[model samples]
Target: MSDQQKRLQMALDAAHMSIWDSRIVDGQVIDGTVSWSARGAALLGLEEKALTQAFRDFLACVHADDRARVLDVLQDGVQRHGGYDIQYRVIWPDGSEHWLAARAQVFTGASGQPERTLGIIWDITERTRQEIMIAERKELAEVTLSSIGDAVITTDPHGKTRYLNRMAEQLTGWTSQLAQGLDIWDTMPLADEQTGATLEHVAVKCLHQRQTIGTSAHTNLVTRDGRQVAIEDSAAPIWSRDGEILGAVVVFRDVSHERKLSQQLSWQATHDHLTGLINRRHFEQLVAGALHTAKEQGHVHALLYLDLDQFKIINDTCGHSAGDLLLQLLAKLLQSQMRDSDILARLGGDELGVLLPHCPMEHARQVGEQLRQSIRDFHFAWDSRSYELGVSIGMVEINQDSKSLSELLIAADQACYLAKEQGRNRIHVYQEADVMLAQRRGEMLWIARLKEAFEQQYFRLYAMPIVHLREGLESHDEVLLRIRNSKGDLILPGAFIPAAERYDMMISIDRWVIRAVCAHIQSVRDSLAPVEALVEQRRRAPALYSINLSGMSLADSGLQDYITEQFVQYAIAPEQVCFEITETAVIANLPKAQVFMHHLKALGCRFSLDDFGAGFSSFGYLKALPVDYLKIDGVFVRDIATNAINRAMVKAINEVGHVMGLKTVAEYVEDEATLAIIRELGVDYAQGHAVGNLRPLVAGLD
Candidate 1:
């Protein structure tokens, strides 16, 4: 061997390299021999005799899977380039495998004629094992990045995204291919919750600092279509092996589901579960906010408090299921009529509240009127019953200079009471000079006392007889509700009704009246003959009983059902029950009132158009109301004997009622002169002082 060959041999032996030498002829290894250092022999499991043969024979010892690839590389170099230097595989006698890196060169004569080739080999098993492990780990990392549950986005130094995981795709609604090479902030727009500023406000700061940053807190992210998705995210600088900083990698999870869950829980804390509207708790918060804004902005807000009129009648007459249906329908109707900015909510059982932000006094009135009109226009049906729902709205525009939330709410509630007092299906706006705050306070106190009376059944029924003017005999009696205070003084309807309506205590009073009237009728079932023989008591046997229906009673579609059930429960004949409807109510919701009237008439009950000629006397209203009697307004009756217009109105109303098969009754008749004029005008019944003083008859039949 030459000096260089001797030196290379000594170095290979000391380095513990496995070595081989091959002689190539005719493009094949003609002869070869192997030698191994201790470690190299362990890698290959072979000694010198194994390699002392044609290299092709030695290659036959390679693992079947790797043999063909190694052979191809060797053959390609021998034929195409006339030389070979490649790393490949080999097999030991025990069928185990190891890698070998070989270098070879062709030996030729001066004329360049092909001759045998010489080559040397080194075992590369440990190096090959490390490479395989590294490749496997790289594959696992790729899989993990692709399949992670939370969205992962990695960006370049320019804030341009370069990687997106599967979760990121779904959350952002973008595929990796589409998201890659795009600026992250531009791709996924996000905004500040308070100011609606872009989240990029801090992005440039993060990029310049090269410092890892977890977003200080959760912020609002907007999806492609502007849906707010809450997210928790953090960013960190990526680096190269040489420590050169790359872009940031941001890891984020769509917390929208979490946010929605929290919002749901929060909403449940302050909202009505059934209607999904703000409840009283939320309402208090809203009113407080409105009052503050009104104070700060120098603008006034309005509170519209609404009570469904006659709602109890519906609830009592129908089942609670029907009542629930009616309430849902009413909620829908109210919501449809309000603006998106208006704060509308179901306060509680048949009551609703509306907060009109930045609303002026006139605008509040308009809104109140709009709600009243909408409710009066809504018609609903259940089974064989059908009716329009009506609302009595009380509105109080914030006196920015004077009122607090509580004061404003009370004022609005008072106006709502007045609306009901005016016979329902109406809107009453609080005016500057309406009532003193102290007076409302006193009225509230009175309502508290009235509630006590209702609970204790301290109310009494006083009868006003309706005497036939010509026949000089009493026929029916109107039952007026009177309350006895602790002082035992009889308080009139006008004195306590407004308070009752305000507190929603009228429903109890109405129930008491119904029960008392029913019990009284039962008590008087057997006194007809003796009462008839009394000279002044002729034709008083069929004294039909009448009790005024509060507006709240009418708003309840169930109230009619309750009354019917009560009548049945008490064995009271339908003919003995008379319902009085104010002219204003009938016209306020003509369609709905018509439906209610139809049901009442179906029960064989009678209807009276009370206070006729007091409102807008549309001929259409007269034609529509299913009234059995027309009660002339006291205004017309009081002056009928003197004022020509008053006389004309009374005569015309009497004619219309008579023409329509209804009896005409004159109200407030006080003297012989007024009585004579009404009789001459063809009025059928006379009431008021002129007819006869009212008194409770004996508990017997006439």
Candidate 2:
């Protein structure tokens, strides 16, 4: 080569490129010299002095696997009378490998004879290494995606499935091969759990934004078999290196079990766990809504507040478990009697309220009566023992003119008080006057008063003697709750108990009663020795004193504990306590009361079914109460000696009580003739103004 040509070749060699020249004659290499730049020599593993080597020797530098194929290609190129460009791997002399890309051109003589071939070689080692590394990374990513437990799927820009991992196959029951190229929505339907509507909008949004969209809970997707499966999923847009939106990739996991757990929690929040009835909070909300609707639509709605009579006795004697069963059974009964539009809610314990939308006062009356009768006729049995359940219902009709929910509730509560006062197990409608008063107040003045009164000792106790009709002697005295107004006038319990109960103040009042009764008993024991022995002998430590228990108090789970604490603090024996619960309250929250009864009985406390055979007289409930006595309702005794029905009822009750090993007491007994008739009917005790009106604890002694 000339000196200038050699220098040019040396310059190109320093630039890390290669050059070659070859002479071709009839498809045979007449002569050839291949020179490579330093980098190219390093890539091909050839020394600079070996540039004149034979073509066959140069071919040996190519990886053995690629040698034959490369040589054949070169031979074919010569035969075709041209040059070639190709990329191949070369094992260098230093045992290192490189990628080389060679390009060549053929020069022919004017006579058309193939002449010299000149080729350029370049070191492509870095590019080749980078490409291999990219390929390896892609493979690893695919493998990792497939290995995930969550289903993974990728779709093309058109939303056609392009890839699916193993989890996708397992979850959707479709193999990747079958899923690929199919529209994603068609392959797996997505829906909202609550609305049951297709998630077409979300899918469209994902496609438009080229971003991921998914939920981790409360979502549903369809599988191949058309079964809906709840799942949580997320999708993200896939992009190419150039920032082109390729499609979207999504990850999903089945959460059917988690969804079920969430549903269960929701149920617990809104429903009573024991009886599966609407809970107090939920019931209040339902009533509030009903009132709003009724007022807005100018429609009348009835609110019925109910309590089971003598339920505590059933609970105390039969055990709380039995009481619970009875309550559950009663709930079923109440539900059956009401229209589908009616909402029945347990206001905690043995108290339940029903909202009757579109119902007028007349309809409310009919429904309440029917409900009372159903309970009256119902027979509840625990173990081998059978009891009759009775309910007292008070109802108030509300129209657009009604002030508020609180006013409506107060009216209904006042009616309930009237029901209990007139005789339990009956239904009472709110009087117009009472409703007007409540509406005028708009605000609940009673609630505020009760709260203040509870703190200020505005309450007092009165004693009514429970006399033995046969001996004409006082057996024990029943303690009656009375409130004194600011003017010092005595007010009956019926005027205030409903108010206290309506505002959830009954719990406080009950606690006060306990303290008051305890103090009264202590006073009687200190002042009257004969009365103390009489009470002690009757298991009424301070004298078999009777105290009323509200339906709310019966339902309070804390009631038994409160009673226990009172006894512990006051050093009072359970046997000295006689809890007087109306027949309606006992049967209303029979289950909860039953638990309280069992606990109280365990402490030697006794119970009485007060106002028995009042408005609601359930023979089954009577049989159920763990009572030592059944107090005949005052209504039955008002004309007991003259009225045949009253006489017959009194006879039946006395007979039933005797048969059940219980004492029968008649309230409202006023004359000797009535007392004589009661005794003839096997009545055990009598209490009334006729027996001599009840007096203050101190005055009674004088």
Candidate 3:
């Protein structure tokens, strides 16, 4: 017990580091055993009884207003295990108010009653006041910076991130906790856009130099996950009152959108907004440069003047948006004809210019003819109407003998005018002795040839087998329509189909195929036993002959009636035929497509949505119309075995079809590996060159 009390007394003595006292409750003050030092008597200015002030007289020193609260706090602390602790004001006899911190512990008897109280008291007015002022200043600084608009960052002297404001955190893709203690340079990486190179550390350089450093133009900050953002900022050293550099502060703003706007404004100055091709002024500048090159360095070049034929007919009927789309599409086609070094531009409305450097007259003519034919073959679809248009291009070759750039441009324009006057779809070379011919003759020849072929029965039917993966020989052949030329040569359908489609000749062709397909089906049915025996193959799935229909035919009011008549005339079952429509055609004429599909479906005919997963693939129309098969586009199926992206696309399409209960047919499966991949992806049918080759639709009749 004595040892315990001695340790307790030592603790109280240590607590009185600056002032105060301790007491043994049973000791007598008159014995002088507890002497108040002379310093304590001097503090009170009383020598008599100064060495022996009763505890109540000491309470008098405590401010009267705080006496009751102090007593209650002490009583509450006396019941606890640690001690009684309080900070309160003390008023000396001289009326001086000072802060005092006091703490005490009470030792209890076996019955838990008070035995002896040991305590200490000290003055703490200066320390408490300083702490409160520091807290208020820190809070004020935090509030001001947090509300600032610009991004702010502060790093330590060692170039580690110490703080990041909200904007800074968003721009850097790093939060305060995650970025703190990380190298500031790594957190806010900067790159020189022009050179694709990293710049020096911003904060470290500022601290070393003790001055602000501004960033240069075309500087981009690389964020945490590697996105480059154009940014503008400056870094300055953070200094203390004594002019000692502590760390650095950086203020930056995101300028990515602003930079893009500036660049776009510059580009719009020289390029057409609609077609994104060089404008008239830029095209003329190129031609002028080409003429100079020919004169000074003996270099040869060519320039072409192209004017659209029948553009007004289509543009006036359809809206201007359609005309703009056609112009943009033609620009892409023109680009396909030239090398990257060649310049193609939209000279004006319905007119274009092409500049070919280091070219002879012969090569320029070929390119000019190629552009002319491409436009002649293109079928422009606009608002449920399809238009066939043409381009009349004039070629002018630049040589050392060329007088001037203005003269060459004039000659090219004159030749182009002649092409347009002659008929609209021909290319004319600006030769001194070249004769004027009627351009109308070119288009007249195609229309006349198509009419002759329709009368001569020159059109033929060919079918490529669509083999079901599980059914083997029990497959359908897709009926392809082809036309024979007068020379008895087999010209591919691509050669004449676009022209026919542009002129609204496909509906007639589609009718002929449906009629022929019925005959083909009947022939196969009559010889099924012998044919299967000849090929040594047995069928599993029911045979259905599939035929393609165009968007124009789908919207034709008379097409549905003509189809009904053909079905009755051929005595063919609707179950034996499948109508295939391109996805683009369906999207273009949705209401007509739905009505046509539903009408045929009512008659037990199957429908296959061909060329799905081609472009703008969407399930938005899937629920609107009913379809049996989703034919994967050849472009996607052709490379699934080797391409990861193709595999993902094919897998996604297959899953969507299966969910809708539609069988999927993979096209362009030309190899065994591709077939393996398609089969693994759960496609129901495989149709392509690998499955079968094109054959005469009527084998025995031919």
Tens digits of per-residue lDDT for model 3, 1-702: 599877865664575332344343433211112234443443443452337566567667778888777766755555563457887767876787767776667666676655445555555768877876888887776666677877888988778999988888899899978999999888899888778698887777898888998865788889999998898878998888998877899888898877877786567568876688999888898899999999999999998999987886675456454676898898888798789999998987788999999989888888887888888889998878788988888888898998987888877886886777677789888876442332354356667777887898878888888888886556688988766667765545655776678677888878888878877666666666876745543435457789998888899888778877877876778888899998889999999889889998999899999889766656777778789989987767776776566687799999999999999999878778998998898899998666776777865322
TM-score of each: 0.51, 0.55, 0.51
Q: Score candidate 3 by lDDT.
A: 0.77
> Which one wins by TM-score: 1 or 2?
2
Candidate lDDT scores, in order, read 0.73, 0.76, 0.77
Error of 1 at 263 (Å): 7.5
Candidate 3 wrong stretches, greater than 4 Å: 1-160, 163-186, 192-340, 343-439, 528-539, 700-702
The candidate with the higher TM-score, 2 or 3, is 2
RMSD of every candidate to native, in Å, equals 22.0, 19.0, 15.7
TM-score of 1: 0.51
**Backbone clashes per model, in order?**
37, 35, 5
What residue runs in model 2 are displaced by over 4 Å at the alpha carbon? 1-39, 44-97, 100-122, 210-218, 240-243, 432-702
Compose the digit string of candidate 2's lDDT tens values, residues 646-687: 687789888988899988889878677888888787788888
The local lDDT score (0 to 100) that residue 87 gets in candidate 1 is 78
